[model samples]
Target: KKNMVKTGKAALLLWCQKRTEGYKGVQVTNFTKSWKDGLAFAALYHSFYPDEIPFNSLSSKSSAEILEMCFACGLRHGIPRLLDVEDIVEMPSPEPFSMMTYLSQCYHTMEGGQKGRSGLASIQVNESQQRQQPA
Candidate 1:
């Protein structure tokens, strides 16, 4: 059971890393410490809805403010506000399960809006299809 949990966490972490790959200053190494600054959540949100949230403009905000914006955006898109901003802001590292649950909800919410595949998978499929086409 422990190993299964670890594997699940690893997969979720990898999914987040792939989603937030090119966003500046956002590195998702884990569900806890990596999200302490709230940039990871913002990056993930921006990755799916780039036009909705300006990624570059978030640099000036405090961590709490950033988290508030991110959570608000999520709520707008129907993802529940699972993690409290105060709890996250006060802790050096937020609780892993809470982070993971919130992240998983974000993942499902974003991916559900896609055409039956994750964003990364859709991009890869498009690239492969383009490669197979004749000049």
Candidate 2:
């Protein structure tokens, strides 16, 4: 269950990078080759499928234990530059932007956020103010 999130995230980032970033929505030349290579990871990442299987060995483990193992397996390591994995890997902070949110924020949004960080959300000069004149 936990690993599925990791799988989806990697696939999603790879999806985003291949589909959204530098290539301009086009698949890279080696995409199919990489996808084919990805299939061989089915055992360690086997839980990443729509299908389910019981693991007698893991039945006794806690979810945290399973998640720890997933991290150790490097299941969630390859991250887009938007997410600072080191900053987030520790734990809960007052951040509205969690790791997933950070991932989704992407390049353009980061630029916008940096602008907003200076504190003005958006200052819309009203028509009346526009009409009043620029002094």
Candidate 3:
């Protein structure tokens, strides 16, 4: 099960990298000191907010408009968290999400799609009402 989960994450990250070609503001190469980390960051944000990252969908958009959207995404969530947690000088270090909990949450929600399952995503949410049982 662990191996399967890792494989799924790897596949997702690869797909994320491919999708980032449309982003002009952050040149995937020059934008981040670590390419893999940068790509993974972009992918996670993209997965959570697909509508925010449009491809050739907006032909009428000016360069400045596209840049604003990309910048908003890059600075808004995971990236800032990543910077706060990791030593930025070290490229490709594993820092998970800026808030590590979100990574697991995202994986749980999206992992179903990786197994040829259509939109049946699972969420590992812990309700406050459900208290832990003492052993």
- The lDDT of each candidate is 0.82, 0.34, 0.41
Extract clashing residue pairs from model 1.
none
Model 2 spans > 4 angstroms off: 1-44, 47-56, 75-135
User: What is candidate 1's CA lDDT for residue 20?
Assistant: 91
Model 1: ten consecutive residues of lowest lDDT: 115-124
**TM-score ranking, high to low:** 1, 3, 2
Ranking by lDDT: 1, 3, 2
> Model 2: how large is the Cα RMSD against the reference?
17.8
Please state the error at residue 9 of candidate 3 in Å: 2.0
Instruction: Give the per-residue lDDT digits (tens) of candidate 2, residues 6-62.
Output: 544444344334333332112323222222212212222333321331223454655
User: For candidate 2, what is the TM-score?
Assistant: 0.23
Error of 1 at 24 (Å): 1.2
* lDDT for residue 50 in candidate 3, whole number 0-100: 79
**lDDT of predicted model 3:** 0.41
